[model samples]
Target: MSLKSVSAKIFAKIVVLRIQKWANNPIETQQKVFKQLISEAKNTVFGKDHDFENISSFENFAKQVPVRDYEELKPYVDRMVSGEKDILWPGKPLYFAKTSGTTSGAKFIPLTKESMPYHIEAARNAILCYINETGNAAFVDGKMIFLQGSPEMQEKNGIKTGRLSGIVAHYVPAYLQKNRLPSLETNCIEDWETKVDAIVEETKNQDMTVISGIPSWVQMYFEKLQKSTGHKVGDLFKNFNLFIYGGVNFEPYRAKFENLIGRKVDSIELFPASEGFFAFQDSQKEKGMLLLLNSGIFYEFIEATTFFDENPKRLTIGEVKTEVNYVMLISTNAGLWAYNLGDTVQFISTKPYRVIVSGRIKHFISAFGEHVIGKEVEEAMHKAISAFNFSITEFTVAPQITTSEGELPYHEWLVEFDNTPENLQKVAEYLDSEMQRQNSYYLDLIVGKVLQPLKIISLKKNSFQEFMKSQGKLGGQNKVPRLSNDRKIADALVKI
Candidate 1:
């Protein structure tokens, strides 16, 4: 082995040791982490405003700092963006991670010097943990390609602003840079299509061992690579063995990805968002991601069913129960306090606190009292797809509220198919049935004749991509909302 490979293995082993120490007692680790975060931010404006000094317990902290969404926290973020120092953190943030917004045009999430290590370390530890668990460290010797957005960041009010991946790329350690693929110059290409082409040309003959990115974009790149070489990804990169994916659930695309790779490769799921690097799949034996308890972020959970209540019950790590879906609230080193990340998760294990990302609070359809969430839709789609032998490229669900007089409303699905099933109607029926099985409210609406059966709209190839492009959200961290209460996205898809 080369000297760099030997050093990489040693670093991975050290990270594994650290992960074991943290995993020894998750509860105690979280407690210590929370206290440290509070102490670090005690002198900041938000900290003094909330009297963080006197808060000794999680209860006191929760009571003193009311849970806040992006809207409630916008003023502080705005002040920071306007170049205010010590507004939310101890000092000005190094950069801002830009994310898609609902009401606002875009959200500028802060990334501080202190918090940067947590993001980088968590990702590094995830890979190390995988190596430790699977005894597969040889991949570290080869190139790892991160299929992400352009590394070119724009400056906003003297703060660098860009996609989280781009920001993270700026901090990749020098050692790993030697084994990273798709040269920095190619990574800075503004257009995703042009960038993918450049990446294919640069890495076609390289020793690529791991590929990481959102599944859809990675699939697109894989397809392009195959088209260019006239060979499957596995044939092109014989050493390729690991796929690290996040930003979306992989179940729907699992079959498609395996086909592209020409084999089933080991994969890892990550829960990194613009807000924080929250959780990662730490074990091959475990079904869910092990929550990063000691990361520089304090986590709180509120029952998803009561998330909109005037006073929702905030539960600490000690109070959280297994199998219950809760909206995640976070207070991080990067100046966010009791901020709602909008994600809902269910704890599959409580001893070490492994969680599955259930869905988003905003990504749900509740027309006529029949509330349906992203999880239900995704599960239903997976079942239907499997039964019908269909492969989907992309899909989104929206409630069709408008109808003629005496006509019942229904859910509309705009789907882009990679391989269409024999009968589209059967596929739609199976999906509706699976959804009804999962959600009792949806079933009741159908049984009571309150709503008609769901309708499927087969979108032309690249329809969703066209829609995303039209909205100026074609690449990077941008994702199509899977479930929307309104028909805005659906109508746009139809027009496309």
Candidate 2:
């Protein structure tokens, strides 16, 4: 916050712009850059010192590296936490970012001081872009919010054990640090009740320049705030800065936030995980998020869906199908290689390489976005529909559309239930509100009443068995996936 520090950051911002300008075409830029990083990763994995003067040397080393997953990095975590300095990046590491995916259990990825500089750079670049794009940086004069994980990290043998958020928080700019809002979930001490009781009073009047965290928590918190005080957030704060978040999309909960303040706000993206901050929106355009490849990690793009009779193929940055979905693979400075990130993405543009989140590749419904992931749909619908002394024990959602026809105009939501009203017309209105309250795109794409209403599936006992039998994943890790690609489940849910 000092003049010297501020001036230095301004200089760094200019350098980033110059570098970004040179990478005009993201496809070519990624291909050339990735090949270099890939080469360095290979050498690093095999025990080699990096010649930091020129990054190209690391690129050369990546060629000899072998692909690895999280399980393969256990030895490094143990050694690094033990204070050994020869692991992934040189020097003592601060903390590991905590993340959990489909294949890997909750993994705390190690972060060294050398790599931390880049992590800060990549994330800060995005923040700068948000400021430049919206011209809304003036709000920073107020307070900003980050709905981060807990501020606690476990320590072992004088070294901290656990994810990087706590460690990263320690390193954040001290002035900015003063404005961070604590998490309602993780910041708890059973024996210390006074601290828990104090957060509400402390946070009640903080100059929150930025509000960031999980969308679900963000939505739930604001609702709680309103219900508790009977006064909206706008009445409390005259100028709320920005909402920076990760882990999930904010489109679903946009309505609630915008409605609360009576003004629309732009939300920024943060893709950091236990792995690392891979990419962030470029702070140049309306949604100019860019991939930070040269930082501590390199990336690989894999085919998301192969034809029924075709083989799976790995695509490079150039080969990524525009507008098609892909499974992301990571090779990070923390010693993780070729690890598949369960989320899916769609490339919207190649110049400056842009992407739109399609949905979870592992989480799908008949290949449609409607394939609701997690138990939210059942929970939301149950709360909305079961007011008349009725409740839902089990339910499922599937997309049923005439794929065989020309550009099927609409998709239908098939819902199964027992002991419900015969008239299912209200299904569309109620579920739509819940879905829209959750994702903004769902509201945008499925607007108007063209799509089929929520077709209630009144099920008989043991009927869900037939449903489970149809998916082949029943009783397994896959479990009858809550969302499906076809509407067969909804079609049958209406029958009983």
Please identify model 1 stretches exceeding 4 Å from their true place: 1-13, 156-158
- What tens-digit string does per-residue lDDT give for candidate 1 at 389-432? 77888999988878889999999998998887878888888998
Q: How far does residue 167 in candidate 1 sit from its true spot (Å)? A: 1.4
Q: What would the per-residue lDDT of candidate 2 be over residues 1-496, giving only the tens digit for each residue?
A: 4453455456556756765764465555555655554454434422453342333532443344433456665666667667776566545556666554335555667766556777677667777766554545555456565544445767655557554554565567765654455543434322222332344455557665566665544654565556656667666665664677665544434544666645756668777665677767665353534666556565666655551224345555666767565777776555555556555666656666666554455556434344344334544565555433343334556665654545543445444333455555565567656776665445555664334434444567545445554543222112233455665556655554
Model 2 residue 325 CA deviation in Å: 0.7
Instruction: List per-prediction Cα lDDT, in the order shown.
Output: 0.88, 0.54
Best by lDDT: 1
Candidate 1 overall lDDT versus native: 0.88
Q: What TM-score does model 2 achieve against the real structure?
A: 0.66
lDDT of 2: 0.54
Candidate 2: deviation at residue 288, Å?
A: 6.7
